[model samples]
Target chain A: MRLADNYEKNGDLIVTTLYDYARRIANQVTVVKDQGRDWDQLIDDLVTSKYFGYPLMFLLLGVVFWITIVGANCPSQLLSDLFFWFEGQLTFVFQLVQAPEWLYGLLVLGVYRGLSWVVSVMLPPMAIFFPLFTLLEDLGYLPRVAFNLDHLFKRSGAHGKMSLTMSMGFGCNAAGVIAARIIESPRERLIAILTNNFVPCNGRFPGLIAMSSMFMAVGISMASSSLVSALVVASIVITGIMITLAISWLLSRTLLKGESSSFTLELPPYRKPQVITVLIRSFFDRTIFVLWRAVKVAAPAGALIWFLANITVGEYSFIAYLADFLDPLGRIMGLDGVILLAFILGLPANEIVIPIMVMTYLSEGAMIELDSLSAFRQLLLDQGWTWLTALNFMLFSLLHFPCGTTLLTIKKETGSKKWTILAAVLPTIVGIIVCTVIAWIVG
Target chain B: MLMIISLDQLPVGESGIVTVIDAHGLTRRRLLDLGLVPGTVVKTIRKSPAGDPIAYLIRGSIVALRVNDSKQISIKPFSEVAINE
Candidate 1:
């Protein structure tokens, strides 16, 4: 107890108790005989093999994404239904009390709706994604992932740890920026910090999910839209991965020009993942923390969104006015005011886009029943959405500037206002360019 | 003086002992912790597009180290020179 206390209180890097535990385990670990082995050549043969290496890497990536998509669906729907039902109950109770109309609207519609959306949309996916990702981290597949891409990164003149940072981008760009510390080179780290936004953060996942499900309903079979949405989400994530590689390559040659640093990667031994621990750790550390942040941010955001939709200026609400201002830019990208409005309000969290869009569109249509996917489709049809618009929206979601939280994180991570601004703007530029080009060519 | 050599300059399929560790400080410690030591037999595993940081095999595992870091460590390429005349 005293030793544990000392370890906890002291300013020390060495975790003595943890080291002791590691040492105890180390004794039982027989050193794999260092026979006259040529391990470097062997790993080289495997990773650099013209055919096998990259294909294998892609396979692993697809498999991990597939797992995330397949796993997160059920709980997301259930949570959404449960929360909405709870909201109905609150409204009924408030109505019975004869509470002031403004009080009920402010409390239930503004705050409760926002918090419920945060939990339902963000929780299920993160609950599944973070633990699965933590499993890979625990198995040390990340080092191999870095090893696989090190040469490419070197060619780009970026530090190898950018590979790991990009992987972190899968979960959250903010965390990905934080992971840049693992790269010791300041120049390379800067390059990573700048391009990290190319890998879509969690805020964009909802947009990806909505687009994926809506378009993939091509087959006559009845598999449900959530399943299709999940697939689209996975593919969009794959697109984000491709963009990271491309941008990294671009930066290496242009802004950060230097020789690539070569370094060895050590694959830690794999262990049987402890399920109970994974659940506890991931739930409290990741899902709940994100949920809490979303809830906090969503309160003001929801109130503001409510205010904008409610308060009108000369025949148009604040939202409509803002969208009108952004309409020209939106039109150039083949999107209209409503879509642009959704993206703007989605700055707090991507998960709220569908809900917020539903609310706004309902106001425009005078009604919308969003209980299921079909009704949602009807709402979209009411707005005259097309395949082109959906495609553009997804591309914008994947490529645009990150959410407010992620921007703040980039600022904190880089400690340079200039880079932080670039991190946000570079991707916005890419989104607008690619989106514009596609909109033009497709049209 | 200029020393700009591509990673392919290294003999393919030949194993060499690591002599130095040159990379990011975080990467160096990570490599060291992974059992990369001077005089350890390391075989090149793979090369990426344009080939600079070549992946290597050491002590029954795989690692990727860049050409510059690899160059810092000299190697006596394994060879058999048989003289039977």
Candidate 2:
């Protein structure tokens, strides 16, 4: 007790002395220029103003998403076509080499398709999103966002730095998990990691967008469909944030009990973002790294999926049997058996969830390509989807467990399987509860 | 006698000379890193939308600290410090 008191006193003394020295030097040397008006006044007035800050943030983020959605379309299509063409060439080469049928099925049909799906679907958006976010980071806007949201986080009993991690989660949860390092307190850091998955990452955005465009945009014309979809997506993002705060509050109150430790954050001066460096770094560091990990898991997942679809016991294949088993539970959750099976299989990458569902519904027993969103909608309609199904599916997609790469990141970050397992199970439990409740109510 | 007040109590647009930082170990270290040391002049810039956390210009950086955290550090308003000296 004496030693603890001494330590406390010493800390106080250090702070006093440091302040004293800083004041003395500041008084003697500090100079002011442009006395009344500050250099950053305009930007600060706009960016941090109570009314404008939020609107500006939304507008900027919307612009980024707009560019990503519009810019990524052609490239995504081009890549998909190129990969599919290559698949044909690979099959021809296999036939020429007299490769066995099962070998071709496993290697070419299953693994190659899986790898191609991940690369094509996952690459374009991440390639566009990360660099844009990084550009904002470079401009020093992110810290201001952190600054603005700090109070809410503090009130939630979480470290203010969580705002930064939450924004990073918009790109990828693994990146967000890594970004949690900014939180100094171990307890608060854990809260950040555990709650990061609440935000919809790029991987899940396609699924969310598809559902919103199909259901929410019904009766809206073509031009405004995009706007309606954006609004719906924005609402879902807000819901994710609310859930993040709620979970953070619960964890702080229950498991990680402590005062949310205060930290000094220097709101650095905004500068022009360096485009070249930002692009290269985000491309190689974030885009490539996340894509590579997804592919690694996806290839094996594809092989397993193929085996599940192909291996028939008596009459029904394993996937069909599994979906049948899950059908009752899925109905309670307002999703079909095929949808549930797709989610279970989509464990490797959230990007594959819709594809897996489409594949399952078609009874192809392997992942297949969809020609367009309308065709995808037609498949869902044929499966007997209502607005409730679409809503619940989107809810499930938003709230479900993070992908395999994100799970590995959580394990690596916490260095404790206990926390990692909790991280995985927490969201799944929340997803099931929320979806079930919604389903129960709508019924 | 020096008229000391919690930094959060300092009026908007007024500057203060930090005198004592009465915070726990972790918070103290963090405050110091932000240049909240004794002799620095911090000016209150503005309040947030919710009006609890106030932005203060400290050591050439604009920082927003919640009232709860700001209340831990004691400072003398510029006029009070000038009169005392």
Candidate 3:
């Protein structure tokens, strides 16, 4: 210890010295082989080039989202059909046993239907999206994405790697919050965590896609409607990214004031993505995990929603009373009371927000699955939805508070109650402010 | 004569020998740990779309550094004549 103290070298000097020795040893022992062509450098040259980089990134993102939206439709329809068929069997079994109506309502209508709705609606897209995203990650493109978008993040006074975390947010916000650990600096990591909710996760994507498709349906060709909807969803994602940057800038300058930390991102060589491995890994690790959480939350939420729609007050159901109480505030945000109530009740899991709203609107004990986007749009239109309301709903969904799982993740990650609450409040406030302004403007 | 310039100023596709890393604390340590020590040959590979952070080849690995951080690294460019020699 005394000898080390006498040497008095700083950490940087020690690392430099050690690397110097290692480099010298490697130079002496290793034989050089000229591979002639460097594929990695060639790829990086194009990928990280100033002109092609941003366009390639956006094109890749658009293609992935387009593929996910188009590909999941058939499987989602099939899954819904299978589940509802099972529901029929369940109904038969209930009648055979002569179960009470309340028991039937709670079990077959409430819990089982809710679980099926989540699985059928959420599973197909998630199963498709996660594997595609994981393929990019496995191919080492994500770090290059961070590399490409670092300048924007740096301008926001946040670490560059926040881009990586934000991309993870597209999968799930809880996972995104966990991904913030890659940002070594505490202040910037918090910024990443707080701003992650601005990006709509997979849970909210179904709603956004449906709304965009429904909105695009009018005055557009059938073939191009999906393409336009994908573009609309992409634009919503861009809006979310802008909000993320703006909020990150606000937090860094105001609450979490600090200079942005230095980070060195190693752009790894792209490898041949293992197709089967990526499929299986993303299936179990992300899709199944998220589906399980959504199902767990959706079951009880379904039961509660069923009760709310069934239990009568004076003239209306309990949910109607709650919606009436929130109608004024919801109107200010260009949404009805039931919409706001759905958001609140759907806090446990975003996958059920639309289902809850539909159940309330129908005033039915069970959440019903519509056969087509037009049917869903017809229901919303019957409820007096305008373009303004649809826009504001998408905006609100994009900017609202993180779900319960994400809040818990923020709490566990930051290990501070203050930050966790701030994480929840900051976005919710932004969401409310944005929604209200848009509503007033449209009005 | 060799010209000394900040790493951030080295044009893409140019090679230079690192002279000094004028950063402090963790940043400096990270740069050194990535084998950016003096006398190491570094190549400016590509710039991001925004042209602020640039990728560099150092010790056979590609590492990206933002302009603010990369400016702290000083290097001596190898002249065309020197490369030919």
Candidate 4:
């Protein structure tokens, strides 16, 4: 009669008991338990909430940017001193060897100085920033960031995953392009690739950090100033983000289409990031690797810049004359020809814009000093700059073309020349237009 | 019922869990590679002040995606289906 009740085999109490225990063990030990009984519902409810979720995300974002800005300062100054001293020694060695004057000009003045900027300016911030950023990633905070903004991304007609890719863009646009591989729609992926230049990469960050600190945060309290500069960069980054959204919206409605994909997002429990592991991975995997890549490209670029500055065709070298030619257009955008030239040359690396500009303006064939941020500020002003100039420069820098590495990365990821070209060109057009409009309005 | 976001409408702080892995081809694989499985949670961390490819966190990694691409995802809150407690 009990057998008629089912496959229970009720008379076999011992076997039944063992079966129950085994099932319990399997559920507890082998599988991730859904103690989350209605986890799907719980996640959905929280993600969709109109009030609490988004503000928390903004608070976190402000926190991250604040930390990156604050943390990057002291080390930046220290690296600057060490590299400058190295440059001084290298200069003395060149003199002792009785190196040809032009040889000195090319290697010591042009190449080494550029390398120093790359090393000193680019390294510290990345060292301090990447690990901290990685800590956020490790703690499972980022997915929740995407979850909170999914609705906004959807309305913009872009893929939600673009949010994640763009975050990578802040570290380095090339990495960001690689990150774009996360978008599930081909059209959406294309859009992500095209728009990623909006975020300031490490190369671009020096410009942002230099300008914002000089112009915006000159006299604030010790702690306040750092936070202010970061907020400023984040502000530009936020603008780039907005533009990315606007462009994607325009693309999807007109060209790309389909729907936003539905995917599951899991927010892992927050854990203390293992510091040793994080430092090792970030230093080896990201910081040093990026530095090495920059150096490989930068050496050739250094030679090119030297040649461009020194080789005179008529009264000016090819680069100088070209900058002269570009000046009118640059003026239309509230920038001058030299700045435009710097952007074009800086395509190989954004890290050199300030140095290039100083070299071109000073006629010293290279940027000379790194004593203080104030000195950098003085150099820009001496070259016909104003607050409008600084503002426009920041905007253009924030919104301009992807650096050479990023462009190549886009090519690698898309495996298509057409998409890569589109990625490079679209932002330049937007940058010029946006900067021009602002320059006109503010002028 | 599920609502589709046009890339432009996604706000700075909104959050959503994936309801469909609806994108096709390589793009689909791209999402999956970032641990964006069908049941994963997503949150918008910050929008650049100018807005566009807002930053979002997926799984444990931070990724920035454009608003247009987010349009492909069709999501509805659990609260929409269940009575809110």
lDDT of 4 by residue, A1-443 (tens): 44533332332233435545655676787755545425533543454355656555555556666776677667777877887888789889988988898988788767776677677767777787778778878865676666666666777767767878888887788888888777666888888888888877767766776677677776779788877776777678678778888888887887677556544344454466888899889988888977886677666677777888888988878777888899999999999999888888777777777667666665533454855566667877777788778878899998778787788888899899988888878888898999999998988
- CA-RMSD of model 3: 3.1
> Which ranges of candidate 4 are over 4 A from the true structure?
A1-25, A28-56, A364-368, B1-85
2 against 3, candidate with superior DockQ: 3
Chain B: TM-scores of all predictions: 0.62, 0.92, 0.91, 0.70
Residue range A20-133, candidate 2, lDDT tens digits: 776678789977564434656667778878898877777776666656655666677788789888998999999999999999988977788767766776688788878987
Top of the candidates by DockQ:
3
Regions more than 4 Å wrong, model 3: A1-17, A24-38, A364-369, B80-85
CA lDDT, candidate 2, residue A431: 88
C-alpha lDDT of all candidate models, in order:
0.67, 0.80, 0.84, 0.70
Q: Pick the candidate with the highest lDDT.
A: 3
Ranking 2 against 3 by lDDT, winner: 3
Clashes in model 2: which pairs? Answer: A19-B37, A19-B38, A19-B39, A20-B38, A23-B39, A23-B40
Per-residue lDDT over A176-256 for candidate 1, one digit per residue giving the tens place of the 0 to 100 score: 888888877777888888777777666666556556656655464444544455555666666776677677778777776
Error of 2 at A95 (Å): 5.9
Q: Let me know the TM-score candidate 4 reaches against the reference structure.
A: 0.75
TM-score of chain A of 1: 0.82
Kept native contacts, as fractions per model, are 0.53, 0.51, 0.83, 0.00
Q: Which residue window of length 10 is worst by lDDT in model 2 chain A?
A: A364-373
For all predictions, the C-alpha RMSD in Å is 8.4, 3.6, 3.1, 9.7
